[model samples]
Target: MDPRVREHAEIIVDHSVDVGPDDEVLLRGHPVAEDLMIAIAELCGERGANLSVRSSSSRVDRAYRKAIDAEDISQSAVSLAGAEATDVAIAVRADANTFETSDIDPEKTSAMARVNKEIQEEIMGKRWVGTQYPAPANAQDAEMSTDAYESFVWGAINKNWAAVREHQAQMVEILDPAEEVRIRSGEETDITMSVAGNPTQNDFAERNLPGGEVFTAPVPDSVEGEVHFDKPLMAQGREVQGVRLRFENGEVVDHSAEKNETVLTAVLNTDPGASRLGELGIGMNRDIDQFTYNMLFDEKMGDTVHMALGRAYEDTVGEANERNDSSMHMDMIVDMSEDSTIEVDGEVVQRDGAFVFEDHFE
Candidate 1:
């Protein structure tokens, strides 16, 4: 019955997924987000829409962690039952990391992730939107004060939509030339790839409006050399830091990490397609500087770039490149603020954490 829950529900139903009167909507959230979930259902009813709510909590995931033995968790009857039943899906994170820092098997965590990925892939038209209902548990160790973290999260999530037309113009100017951009994090990082002839960066306005990222599927076999990720990455509930991946002919030939090497190995070994890169995106929201351990907003933080290891989005590029596979799309971040440069074709477009077009746009 909290007023904020109704406000947040309106944001999701009216903005994020934009549920229509005829749309069959599915709303999923942890117990902490029950208020918002109920608000969404009520909102759907008011809007003349058919809504189904699938409620879950951190305790459910914890149960799976201790009791589940399968590598694929999505195969469970409950998950399979919800796969294609709705036109849109909303996942609200509420204290998901309740036990993240505790003692848990890495293998079990990865297995749970694989299940979620399977559900996402099978329900391709679901038009998923992920966000968070902040909980104290998530901010326990954050470097920034809780107030500051909330500000950062709010600014990052609403950055694109709040400014709308202006944000679109800025994106066009940054990606205008449509050329290959050479990037380096240091001698250890030498990654060069082409973004030429790809779709011009456009707003998801009226569709996936909360989305701040303007991404493209990378050239399947164009990625070459090795690069070390500058930010710590969390996957399948396990944290991986100081990752260095060596690429040969666009496939991950070798990879090592200072933390969670076994989990990384498991991801790379998921399938042949898992070894190849799929997405190459640069974060543009200047308001988001620090990491919050959430990929939805983290991958869109300014002066940073992330690459997904599997499953390129079909709408991102041409159909000639058929490398998209794997149930996973693990996004890992790299900082471009220090001792790094991005050369578009032969022209340098960014250096030392600044963009050449910053003055021209925004």
Candidate 2:
């Protein structure tokens, strides 16, 4: 194992998760992330934490994708129940390839999705963290050296975390100020929303090195107009691009794409909540100026913003507008580098990805 991997392991073990003594820790990832996994286990043991590691792989998943029955796919990962019951659980994404071009049984995938949803509810909002472990595939598709990709991911996480914190504070100040912020993009983007009385919650700030974008749960049924996802999305191991969505009452009334429309439709139709906007986030990490085809990282890149069509996070501004139900959360990015703006309560706060507030972005 590389020494840096060990250093990263320490960060994951100590910083990302404050694993206390006797805490039941569930460490999970695919085989490609094993080095870090082993290091996490070692750290857990040293900390006197009870640790259980679950190593999943793309090859094994391919076997199921090739031969498994749709109805039984959910049952194969039954062991997940134990992990779900643990005190702290971490999912490290280390897939061999981000895009797996195979005839995947949609039904099987759906069943897996359902099971995962059940698991999320089982925890009923427990303390957990999700992160990534860079592999050759993610690096290859990113068109950058692995070292560069690692830095990109790191900077994205670090900067986004900071932005979220800063935005949360700014939101508090803006919420009480007397203003109905009016904002407009340069052209072709007329998106608007009212953040007059929204509560900005602190994202998982005490837990991880999470950074990139700060977000708020928009008022359900309050958004109007259309927006185009300027960047392609990496969905379920495949690249889905050119997504266009039309919203009415903050719900996705109509959507289409030049690519992967079928998959997008299937995901949207997965549940009723899938049709609604869950989160509206702006990427503000200048360090992450390029798209890497990973929503976990890309949505936090500066000059971009994303709208999640389903499942609002617990810590977002808005009322019971919690669109949380679907096992799915999709992040489609819109490049705001040109001809785009975001307003908070009628005041133009961000024009073409730059903050309007003083000392907000420096």
Structural similarity to truth (TM-score) of each candidate:
0.80, 0.82
Model 2 TM: 0.82
lDDT of 2 by residue, 5-119 (tens): 6766666667667898979888878898888788788899999999888887777777767786665555434665684668888778878876562567666766676767767
Whole-model lDDT, model 1: 0.71
Judge candidate 2 at residue 144 and give its lDDT.
85
Residue 53 of model 1: what lDDT?
77
User: Which ranges in model 1 have alpha carbons more than 4 Å from their true place?
Assistant: 1-7, 61-83, 100-122, 141-148, 159-179, 196-210, 360-362
Global Cα lDDT for candidate 2: 0.68
Error of 2 at 211 (Å): 2.7
Each model's RMSD to truth, in Å? 4.0, 3.6
Error of 2 at 167 (Å): 6.8
Candidate 1 per-residue lDDT over residues 176-258, each given as its tens digit:
45667677987688887766555545534234424555677667777888889978888766899999998877888889999
